[model samples]
Target: MAKAIMVQGTMSNAGKSLIVAGLCRIFKQDGYRVAPFKAQNMALNSFITKEGLEMGRAQVVQAEAAGIEPSVLMNPVLLKPTNDTRSQVIINGEVSGNMSAKEYYLKKRDIVPEIQKAYQKLDSLYDIIVIEGAGSPAEINLKENDIVNMHMAKLAKAPVLLAGDIDRGGVFASLAGTMMLFDDSERAMVKGILINKFRGDKTILQPGLDMLEELIHVPAIGVIPYLSVDIDDEDSLTERFEKKGAVGMIDIAVIRLPRISNFTDFNVLEYMPGVTLRYVKTVEELRQPDLIILPGTKNTMEDLLWIRQNGLEASILKHAALGTPIFGVCGGYQMLGTELSDPYGVEAGGTISGMGLLPAKTIFEKEKTRTRVKGRFHSQITGLLSELSGIELEGYEIHMGQTRPIDHQIACLAVLDEISGQQSEEYAGMCDHHIYGSYIHGIFDGEGAAQALVSALLKAKGLDCEEISSVNMRDYKEQQYDLLAKGIRENIDMDQVYQILEKGV
Candidate 1:
């Protein structure tokens, strides 16, 4: 059986996920088999497993830190919000149904059996389990049927480390208020209190920490400094979107849809030298750029309407006509087509006009298309990204629609050599002049794909390509995990953490 320790936060984006990942890395470094578990997660960013199961990306990062393969068992129940009021419920990596906020709240407890099954399976296989909680346990109005915070800790018999974000201010009040709201059972499960994202002198902060511990009767475990490491974020709440960098030698603009998912797809480009990647939400932000990318979103129709109504559609069309390269992925790919038809009412029920950048038509389906594939760009790809021709790439597909060609001018972008590791002949992506679209989420992460695109852009501007440089994404990710583990070791007391795990409630 695995010993469990839980990390709960006073609010969202309190660094709970990052801390769990750090613990996973620490346990892995100590030669113990470890895994991350989150019984329920609500996020737009998600990943597909080798088995074609969908899970939250936060768990995927922790799994990577543990030096283990990402599995659906890490996140058994995923709630992908389609709108403010509703979310698509996925259980064990498969879509169960769409339910409104109230509907899910009323029925979430019904999924407890599945959560237990997943936790038990991981317990049998690993020596330690690092669990993460969502939002706050102190939501007074939503605590009765709570299955993610206090309820989860009790279920796993996990000792909890309650963390409050001092960088957000009100750390003392938030931590004390959270503890004050916790009933006796819930308060007893918390082994320690942590002040996360501390930026200033520890000497000045020590008195407050001491006062917090004395008030809550829980030891101040550690004051974790603001982490500088780069890792995949959980959802749109990520600070990455607020980044506003002046245009570099090579400027890349990504349309920040209200429901953007997997914007991490562009994280690689941010690391390239002289490459400025910016998320543009308004027409003013969508100023002329060397490259324009329309990223994936949870709701294609609604987000497309947003761009259309907000005049970004006109700006993007102007750029497209001027021969600037435009790329789209998944939902963005669907929006680039000439028309989007939802006969099954999978999305908003209707036939809507697409951006008409690509000679393709999309039809939403009842069942999602999920698969992992290895492939290469087709020989016929032309124009700006012609440099990507025949270059190998690997990514997973997770969408609810299929695009069909509308004309001979459009050519297949890539040929899938393998599907889920089986030799097969299947095609993905399409190219029409300077416009390109694909269902593959991590298309840019392919070996040399980003470089090829950057090289072409530089050549078009007649700029010297000598300084064009980028990191190998796989190696970059490994270094980030090590940095996070090192930060935890320096700022956090791992010895006490081990004792808390061993002496679980």
Candidate 2:
């Protein structure tokens, strides 16, 4: 191994992902080429790599911070849950198949060699590799076959920094408890402990940090404060839509349906100047928004039913009646049609009624259409976008349904010409329209599109708002990463960390 460090959380969601990202950025700033690795990641939120491989968007964000193109090697095993008991196992960007919790645990050991291979490949190219472990490393039952936490750390011969979430309270208990559960060899791999998400005074945490270090006989590496970094969330829990506080400017509401997928699409818009993204839990909340966005779902039928049960379906009709700009992507797009027919039962059994926003229908197929597409703009939505009426925009498609027009309704308003960059109007709602729907995700990645859309929503609300510069995700990620890297260097005992990475644990 070149040089490495593993960030193992005391529990899941203890800011491990952010730590890895910060380390990756810091390493890069120190003139060391760094790569982020996670042996396994389970999340519905994902990203399409430059090579057109689908991986967890968390690692992708880290990769962007490191100024590197994302690849499946960054995350060797991805478990995207289709339901509670079952998940789609993506090994190296290709779906191996669906497996139950019991089934996957039994078979995970077989894929250990593949994980090692990916790690070695990354280690070879980078001067340092920062590893992010999944969940808690102290799960005694899972420790036997654990390929993601301590087991992988041992395999990689990397030093580990155990992190605990201070914001959740029990910072001491979580760290001490996790340490107590580990065996001697696993315990030896741990270099020190770090407290994450500390709010208010650092002086207040100093006494707690001193006690933790004394008890564990490990150095307290750093105390990280709560930071509002503008980055895409890894899973449903970190979702901004689940956030409280009503939207400040535009009454932007998202239908908080079950099985929501790829919500990172709205992160940029949510962070834009004078835009408030709200998650609508009830029909009343749904009806009040200036714009309604139906997010992508893993199980379309299940979420569609959730929409109806929550009374969002009727609220959507009411909003549309008032000329609310409704937008949907992929599964959301499928829901906007007249009906969702899964005759072969790919998603669920039989058919379900859609919101009927657009005059269209969707048919679920077994063969999933997964590819990077460049969409050509067709319809005119704003004056700023008029010049872009025929511009090709890059995005991806990861859906199992095909939509067709009903009663002269268009399938996709934007037709992309990949070769010439020429765009023509094919359907009506793929890119931008008052009541729009499209199979393409991340349509806002287009230049000026995010600000334009935000500007449009603000206009609809009749509020004065300034359009900030287009959110260059790649650039913004790098900048934030640089800041984080600086933080880690100044706070962490880098000399000690480097020594551990050099020598096997």
List the candidate 1 regions with Cα displacement exceeding 4 Å: none
- State the lDDT of candidate 1 residue by residue for 1-505, as single tens digits: 9999999999999999999999899899999999999999999999999999999999999999999999999999999999888899999999999999888889978999999999999999999999999999999999998888989889899999999999999999999999999999999999988889999899999888888888889998888999899999889999988987568899999999999998888898988888899999998887879999999999999999999999999999999999999999999999999999999877788999999999899999999988898999897788888988988888899999999989965688999998887999988989988999999978879878888888888988999877776568889999999999999888888889888988899
Question: How large is the C-alpha RMSD of every model relative to the true structure?
Answer: 0.9, 2.9
Model 1 error, position 422 (Å): 1.9
lDDT of 2 by residue, 1-505 (tens): 4687899998889999988988877777778888899999998887766555678988988888777888899998999888888888888887787788999999999999999999999988888888999999999988889999998898778889999998999989999999999999888889878888887988987888888778878888788877767667888787476577745676678777778888877777776776778877687666477678898988898889887887778878887777677889888888888899998767676988888877888998876666666766674543323433554456777877898877663434566554123343334354324677777777777776776677666655567755455777667766676777666676677777676677757
Please give the lDDT score at residue 382 for candidate 1: 85
> Backbone clashes in each candidate structure, one number apiece?
0, 5
Candidate 2 wrongly placed segments (more than 4 Å): 379-392, 407-411, 419-433, 461-469
Sequence-dependent TM-score of model 2: 0.92
lDDT against true structure, model 1: 0.92
